[model samples]
Target: MKNIVNKTFELFSELEHCNNDQQKWKIEEMDGIMREMSEDELNSVLSARMLNKICQMIEEKKMSMENAILLLKCIGYCTMLKRIRVYCFNDSLVNKRFKTLIVDEYKKKEKKNEKLLVDFCECYISLSIYFPSGLLSVCVPCLQKVAFQKEENEEAQNEVEMALMALSNVKNSEVKKELSLNEITDIIEYHQEHHNLTHLAYQSAWQFLIFRFNMERSLEEVIVNELHFVREAARELEELRECVDWKRREKKKGEKEMKEVLIIGRWLDVIVHFFLSCQLWNEEFFGLIGGIESAFQKAKGEHRGICKECISSFTNIERNRAVTIEDLLKGRAVDAVVKEFQTQTLNNEMTYECLTFLMRVLRRLKEEKDEMGEEKINTIKKKLFEKMEEEGHEDIAISFYEILHFFKRRYDNGLSLDISDYFVNVRENG
Candidate 1:
């Protein structure tokens, strides 16, 4: 096996300088050797050696860039090796296998070859189809390294983006085996943290859920606590946006800042999708709805848009019992529901459901005048006014205004109108 590996590398080395005919003969001979080896033997011996040579070609300063890319692609196709992952390349008198090779080397002031790294990332993502853990072991660390880099410069940002794209590809691909719950928790924690809002690594976001694991029952407890992480991300973004333009805050900032908002959005988006897939939102999970509510309260601009989408996925009742307006107000679920109209983002059906809930709350507030809920009632009033102010606002907004008018009509003269007059006035005014 060692002789065959040496002989194969030597033939390729000569073919680099030989004429076209010699190159064809070398490739044909290499194909014969590959055909002779069993899959298990190739996996154990030949495949690993070929992968090492490919990495060597990448680092060898004497080799051409075109040659390295072509040779790697040839190795991928020729052996059709699915299991072996290359660990080391350079001989820097070291023991680490792939030290800093995952990222492009910072050569002097400029970066080393970037295309080579991208091609390698893409190749590994492809290999992930057969061996999920193999690709993940390599990509996860690189994803973390790039995601947390502190440099604010464009080059640093691009490296982060490249890492995300690579991980996203792996996460996006269909896989056969699911990762264990313990394995997924760290990834979930990383993306959900407030630290990520400033420059979120969108790539690390989806790898956890790519296979749609049966983790709902196993992971529910941790998931409940992890939700607050998304809430903090919103708070961080709100602070950042507020700091950026303290004077005229309504004027949205540059696209770069908006992308920062989206980083949080992307993380929350994955969490929502993963949680819903678990199909295991017990009462405990429902209680943590406050985290999402807090997120809704501070969320603004694009952040609010993301929160609005997140709300639709989490409407659950403990049993056959209905989720009353009182419960929502106490838990601040009203804030999340009201975001749909304040942002004018939800479709007509969801908008109507939200409006119906608010109308019930508004009517109850007018009749009962609960001093305990005074602050919440006031907030609802202000949000309703804001919805009315928005242009092209839907009928749901009008229905809300009519509900307010109905309540006004009932007690305007201290002699409350009868039920019949209430309906009559609402239709006429509406």
Candidate 2:
């Protein structure tokens, strides 16, 4: 490796001032040497030497950007060579110098060509690197472009995914905190569509939002408002749930469809995981619970249980949903939620959750001044209790009395109501 590096340098220096004929011969010799060198295993020193030279040539304008990109494909792109990229990319001096070329060859050219965009993004991953606060600015613009790409090309999209995946790697780095962006919303709005690279793209977008939230103040509006996302997430879940029976149909015909069904089930689980994995400060992200409720309503049997898992997550203290009990009855929304409860009343677990949120929402509504809101709450309370009693759910029916009192002013934070008889009544009736 040392000998080859010395010889390659001598030849490179000669080619810099050689006559045209001599230059041509020197170029051929250099290419031959590079090919030979690449054929051997690349250690950190050799790889850094090549990247250092590439960086120097491009910086000095001695090499055309086009040829530089090609030369990278010839040498820097070796799968085997990448194993040592970890070592080479860690050298801060070399990494810093390569930034200029990355900007010139990749950042500037990303939108003009998908192939370059992919290559650029892959460079982030292929290059095991740190993104100290200011050092990562060069890649930020191109990262946005990669996320919102409209093309359906698999490689291009996969590369976009790779670009996002690279961001995840730096999330724990020393300077990791926030990534400020001028076009954060644009990237998000353009990418509501599901990507070919699902988790990669999803986490990439989510992490960006997370970073911006931590780094940038006054971004609460963007971070919390994603009703469309809720709708699409629920829609995709129901679509996957709808396909569950297809496996049985295929089995009846002896077509062995369980494998395909299993894949769809996994995707449903993916959606579940996507929502469940999110960490956010709880706010009234209106329509989200409604969307989840809608997903729960459409699912059946085993699928319904899966949907319930997601609902149960949102109800927990750590993962509490953005939607509040108040958002439930804001408009005609209460109608659909109540109608569904009426239909699913026989589903004991579903009925219990529905009633819990319903009572809490009614109390929230009662605190509001709108007469219609008050009337709406009374109507909901009447319908809710009647169903609980009609279905003989004594515990759920009686619990509403205490849950609603939670909305009223407390007296010494002690027993405001005579619950001694309430539990006894519930026990006797239930």
- For 1-430, candidate 2 gives per-residue lDDT tens digits of 4576577677766644545566556656655555444323334235566567766776776765555544443343332222233456666344665454455665453355655654554454346555644446546555655656667688677656555545534433432223434454555566664434453355455554454443454554455455244445445544444544532433252212232233233333433333444445333334444544444544434345444443443333112343333444342234443443554433246544444444444444444426556455555556544544554545544544555354333322322244322221111122
The runs of at least 3 residues in candidate 1 whose Cα sits more than 4 Å from the true structure, single-residue gaps closed, are: 1-119, 122-161, 168-198, 202-217, 225-252, 278-327, 335-430
TM-score of each: 0.40, 0.42
Judge candidate 2 against the unseen true structure and give its global Cα lDDT, from 0 to 1: 0.46
Cα lDDT listed for each candidate = 0.44, 0.46
Residue-level lDDT of model 1, residues 46-76, one tens digit each, is 4444555545544654344445444444443
